[model samples]
Target chain A: MAPRIDTPGAAAQAVDQIQQLRTRISRLQESTPPSMPLETHPALAGLVQLRAGAAYSVDSATLALALLAGPSRSGGWCAAVGVADFGAEAAAALGVDLGRTVLVPDPGDQWLEVTAALVDVAAVVLVRTTGRVAPQAAEKLAARLRKRGAALVAWGEWPRCEVRLTTREPSWRGVGQGDGHLSSRRLVVEAHRGSAPPRRGALWLPGEDQTYRPERAVPVAAPVEGVA
Target chain B: MVVWCPDWPVVAALADEGLPSHLPAAVFHANLVQSGNAAARSFGVRRGMRRRDAQSRCPELKVYRATPERDSRTFETVLAAVEEQHPGVAPLRPGLAALRSPRRVRGGETAAAALLAERLVELGVWDPRLGVADELFTAEQAARQASSQDCRVIAPGESVPFLRELPVESIDDAADGGDAVSLLRRLGLRTLGELADLPAAAVRDRFGPRVAWVHRVVGGAGAVPLSTRTPPPELARHVDFEPPLDNAETITFSARQTADRVVAGLAAQQLVCTEVRIDAYVEGSDDVVSSRHWLHPRWFTAADLVDRLHWQLQGGFKAGEVRAPVSRVLFTPVTVVPDAVHADGLWGGTDERVQRGIARVQGMLGHEAVVQPVLQGGRAPRERQALVPWGEKPTGLRPAAHPWPGSIPPPAPSRVLATPWPAEVVGTGGRPVSVDARGAVLGEPARFRPEPGDWMPVAAWAGPWPVEELWWEPGGRRVARFQVVGVDGRAWLMTWESPGTWWTEAAYD
Candidate 1:
């Protein structure tokens, strides 16, 4: 013998509350879908985020391969556009899936159109710019990129890019005089962003084992006098 | 059952060139007469005659190059015409197709053939013949005997007697048909009956599987049913703009829906488009404004189709050229491959998001910008690396599996210089390091200078591995290779040829 409320208005009010509850439950479930784990290397730990709709500019193809290696190994599609002379074997040895990779060695003046089309499928696109891009064209391309959630790894300058990375003072190892083949290389990667303090890290572009690894300790160069 | 169009190659050639059948015509393959029209045959221009002999027989013989493409293209229409009369037409070859006896199509086999003949005549084929029998082999023989515009049918169970007197060459096996018949004749087996009468086991032992199969086929013991060819799927996907859009963005926006439809059509057939042919018609005109081919690295998805459409439309008009407003855009998948061949790998190839990202980038940049590396054969490291467009298989590349002569052994250099850096290698007496013709080091190498740097003293050096390439041709190359280790514990690969100068071709790292 709870309170007896037998009116059409009361019934309608109860139905409304139930409908409201159902909508709330659906919204909660929709907003909280399970998130996927991001695939990134320790060398580029915070510099580039996987699945983040952002453009990154890098100086060296070695670092570009290093950055793409993580996504490629984790079952992500990577493409190189207009970078005809990119070192593909190094990329393959770095664990990028050669089968999953696409290379457009040369795409002359119609680069912008090509890049926009590429974002429709490839997860990461590495493009080497040969000419300047109009501001309007860049804006349109960037907008589409953000909408599609595709990452751009520009070899040269890009308009309003999110991250700019550069590699300097690369030293080759495993060669003596005219003997032995080049086995590894060491480089320092510095990342800069708007108003953010630049971050620096040492990397083995391709270490002795032909893989991108964080440099354990910087090697000391012998003094010039000691070279005798 | 067999549907044979007499002198199809000649007929096809004549039709393609708009030549009247009243004129003598011959189609030659490899300079040997393949097919001759009735007019040419009347002039003693027979099949298997050399081109010169045929021309001697009929000086006015319209000599047309034997183009298989034109013949096949014309034959497709014939296939379609026959297909209209009956479904599941199994094309045996150009101008030849077969189907199961459609007993009820127009009352009986003869009636069906007559109907097909009537339809083919309507399609400009003058003399199409049809043959029906209990099995395919006898039916083909029956068709060969039928004259122009005629249909023949051998009653079931009567093929054995009918085939008994036929020549042994009637047993047609693609690989060794002619040779087997010749061999049978040499063995004194002249007729199909004589060849069929031989012991099956004995014939199989003597002639092999192909001839044995042919023997069984001629004896009416083996009957292979006609395998109906699946008709190619229709692939034209089009969109018409109501206002005849001039802006690239607007045109592409409308194209997205059409692209989805095209992809859906392909998916329904369990196929994927590898290449697309697009034809855009101008507003208020029937003429096609632009026609182009677009290749894809992977199977085209809806988004990929849209991107390609957008790219093509934007680049359709060249600089300083008057642009045409696109009234209708038609996308046809010119080439399709089975989906089973391109299904995703065990570890889903690439993330869907990643694929879209790369595709978007390619659209903005251009088609040739993105590339994937493929291993190829060559003596040098640079030559070994080949780039293929993403999603496309590498083709026409030197096989990497072959053992290339004079190629450097494995643990190959990690880095290769695009252009070899010229360097100096001096011996103890300061003479340039050289390799003699006998592949011997001229002198003990002392110091190596790479780009005027501090001369690093060579701690140890390997032999001069000589390479002589293209020796039979002019401008051949002869070079000697050496692996040198410096006092600083670094290694480099150096090469020297005639007029010796050590060039640093690659580094260990």
Candidate 2:
């Protein structure tokens, strides 16, 4: 549980908002609640962890995929895998406000700085990096984000954090679209913490009206950069 | 306490843009500055005279437009960079932003200024001039005197002495010279050094107590550091059309190009310009300036911009009107300002859509057709409102979220009523006395009558909301106004606000 304090100023307000979000996350299931705003809970929050050093041969990818397609009897928020492709189909994700997304430049000297700035701003931060971040810096950033009432949906490999999660590639059946457009692609994705896994259910292309009816599936890679 | 924040990015970008086109891009100072001594002044060079003119006059005036913005931004960056190394630094403005959290010692003021200048050179900011003093004004003066990165601290006990070495006029030598300094200069205290040397008795005797207080500036008194002013909300960008693109296609194309430049510039400033000045040149005559002002109370879209420039195309010399085909089209930013998001946060801080809609309505009906109400400081309705200039930086106009009291609401609009129809009325006693629409017994209402047919109220109303407009002069509207209640429960804000002759000024919408 997040600690409560009686401090004044912007930091205190940020802490209170985040704590409120953490407490509100209890009611959510496997699917996004219809007509509900993000004010209600941390349905989309992701707990990203990292190892001490940089290496690519870790099971993090499989672990992430398993989490995205994990089995949960309860329907809930889609396990979105964020990527940096502007032209990718995930640009039109259901229940996601695309305008809130931010595109960061590659991981050079300014990457960590930019990521830290983006912590409170973006819905998801797709960092294109091949190296691990220092432990203290990551912890500081996570604390800042949580306090700001925002979540860290981190892409790119990092060692570890304190949040537990569940992972699996649950089975999928019923693969078809009502209209002529071919839809539905099978893929495994991950989630952190003891949260239930995402089923292999299909997410449809968000139409002009912006609804996610799960009507069809299209072939698209996970939208996150430097990920599986 | 004036502060100058020469937008370094803007200055650098403009200077860079001017370079490819072979134009000299320097923000040169006016007289008394460049020529610190008598010799250059003998050559007839003034501070702000055009460079070529100065060059012709002095032949070696060392005429250089200042790179103040470079010095300024560099100064700020260096301060930040130094702050990163040493914990706390207090900042003063105009190339001398500092922090006194943990000051550098052993003559820390000078040493720190020098250290910051060194950091600036490392960052590739030019000339690294540094000045440190007890106050912002004197610190800036000290910095200007610095030829290189070495620190020049105005000694704590020696501030008056340090400032006295400079001329008294330099006290008001700020970017936008305040009038107080000018009045002081007119009183003939030529140099600050001289002024400080004068005795207080003599100083106050001839100059008076009010002028005496201003002398403190010459004495280098400390003041709260002034902040850099917020940027203006207007757009201006000049385009140099090469190959003399006089065709309509080229001009319209250039408009879009320059519009993009302005939009990009606004984004960098974190603001927008609701007005733009479009200039077109016939290319050969030399410095032919033709321009018009475009304004909106809100942001305009690319289409709105295209339309205005389209009207402007009629004025542009199309292949037929010039000795040389029109080679260049330019847009100069007159004013650009930050969009004040509603205090309520209804739009999530981006109201571009609403602004664009206003632009369209203004464009179609008329730019003057729609207006947001602003309370001018006057009692009369016309005097109550002066037109609002576009790209006006949001300042003290609307003091708070509350509506302006004793001021009429806007959208009463811009049409003059046809005539003030008069009326005469008989009271319940059926006597031969006259009553105005307001039911006050008057001589007569000039052109109106009570109708047995009209189903309006006959409630007794008060006499004149009297107003006198230019009544002392030969001709003016002296009128009175009052409120009348109808039998149907409708109340009208009739004008007795003006004295005798009456016109309904406004209604509660």
Candidate 3:
């Protein structure tokens, strides 16, 4: 039998101990990564939640940069592997901290090793594979990523990913036939997860003000069909 | 004591050109004679004479460009020779050096000077002169008065008298004393004795600080004590292979100890090396077969140095198949700073874990393969970004804040192609779209092929934003940029070169 003291200090101490135990128990469960509030771009906030120890794939370079900018803006280190055509100015303009970004433009045949090594340090890593990665290599990298509690954003197809983001129905706002320059773009971003219906949202990839934000309630017109 | 080798620039230049010392040679800078050798001086060539005038005076004068670096590099041997005789040698210039008079030598100051002269003569400095006196200024003047390979000794108490008898023009040797020397000459003070007789305060008020200081020194107030330079410690280390190791792995494995020694030596002095020069000497070569300078973002440790050695060896040899067996490998610390500059902050700096991880990756790929992205100002997307290799500082980057007039507007392209892809754009009648020399659009682009065969109709388009870059120089380009959006919703940055060639520079995916 436990003896409880009728004191305010004892009651508070008991509460603290219970909270500590709960956290410990949560940590002990290794099946899934504990969800933490990862800083996501406001334009992608409600559509999908970025969790630690997960792999996310994006079809467009802008979306990859957006995902990377979330962790980088919050003062986390980021790395890009095998992305020879990474546009640094665009990344910086989109709020990615260039100072904390390490880039391996061409990893040659060692892309997997390089990405795995970077995962141990950087909060988020974006990789562009030269060819389709083997299943075993992907599985191995996933385990390492979970253990290190870092996220991976693949620029191309991956064997298995927690979320897959693709940009569709893109339209330029201020461009016309030999007139004004490209000012902004409106794109519909779809996030697909396993067995669940994909989440769709409309956003200005870069609004005319150079800030990314969700589009208003106005419906976008159908894309103009092109001659194939 | 002062050791003076006159006309050092001309001497060093002639030696570098492999010309005989007896030939008339003059070192010129900005078309004016900076220094002339004795042979040129005898032919009426003087410092500050125009190149044409000097050539006219002596048709055979060998005019070589003046390089302070060459002069100093040649003087290093002379300095080392003097330092071998006496430890505290202060180099005043390329040709002049000062040292404390060695009064304790067997033949006193004169004998010590003679000993140094003999050493300089061995180094091909045929006319090295030495002087001993009570102060540095007097000693330097005395050295000038001394004959070739000789010594001039001004007895301790006789410095004042010795300086007084010198001409007022002698003051010009002091830095920024030219105007004062001229003023004194204009005032009819031909000898330093006349200048020294003036009241100290009057000279101080009239001739400025330099002349005032000279007056005080000439008035028998002793000059400041010599601030002797401490000799640099020997931090370079080398390892020699037994029987000349042909295998790269064996060479680096053996060099591990030398690398450790180099780092430890630096640590002993509470310093760290940021730049190191590694040289591998092949068995049959008199010079280094492979030499490269490796820079570290922070300071290097022993392990980093070994990795650099391994990489250097591997890079110099194709697939580790050495062309010539490596006999010796040397490690030289090119740049070192105190460890305090790199000490960890209270909350620690960049995560050491990240540094280690990046280093491991650098081991897998070459160092240049790992880079840090940086933004810079330019008109083109490719020019706006710079990739600095990992563990090296970015240099010569254009500032981004400056307004670039012809630059593309914001909403920069996402994927800046490493190399521009050749492309084709056609108008309504299958005519190739082009931009004329005056930046006029030849035809409205309707369909484009960004790749080899994939054609897409242009959904929206803008520009022929014309830019004439580096037009006055060779290889200059006259390009007109265009922003074209395809039906697939991908936008491309295309440039139309004169005479109808199109290239896709970047894509907004």
Chain A TM-score values for every predicted structure, listed in order: 0.76, 0.42, 0.81
Worst lDDT run of 10 residues, candidate 2 chain A, spans A173-182
Model 1 vs. true fold: TM: 0.59
How well does candidate 2 match the true structure in TM-score terms? 0.31
Error of 2 at B149 (Å): 28
Ranking by TM-score: 3, 1, 2
Candidates, DockQ: 0.21, 0.01, 0.66
Tell me how large the interface RMSD of candidate 1 is: 5.2
lDDT of 3 by residue, B66-120 (tens): 8999999998888889888999989999999999999999988878888889988
Measure candidate 2: CA RMSD: 26.3
Candidate with more favorable, higher DockQ: 1 or 2: 1
The CAPRI category of model 1 is incorrect
The C-alpha stretches of model 3 lying farther than 4 A from their native spots are A1-37, A216-228, B4-71, B92-95, B105-131, B136-227, B232-250, B257-276, B283-288, B319-323, B328-339
Ranking by lDDT: 3, 1, 2
> Model 1: what is its DockQ?
0.21
Instruction: Choose the strongest candidate by DockQ.
Output: 3
- Chain B, TM-score, each prediction? 0.64, 0.39, 0.76
lDDT of 2 by residue, A52-102 (tens): 111111122222222222111112121121222221112222222322222
Give all TM-scores, in the order shown: 0.59, 0.31, 0.79
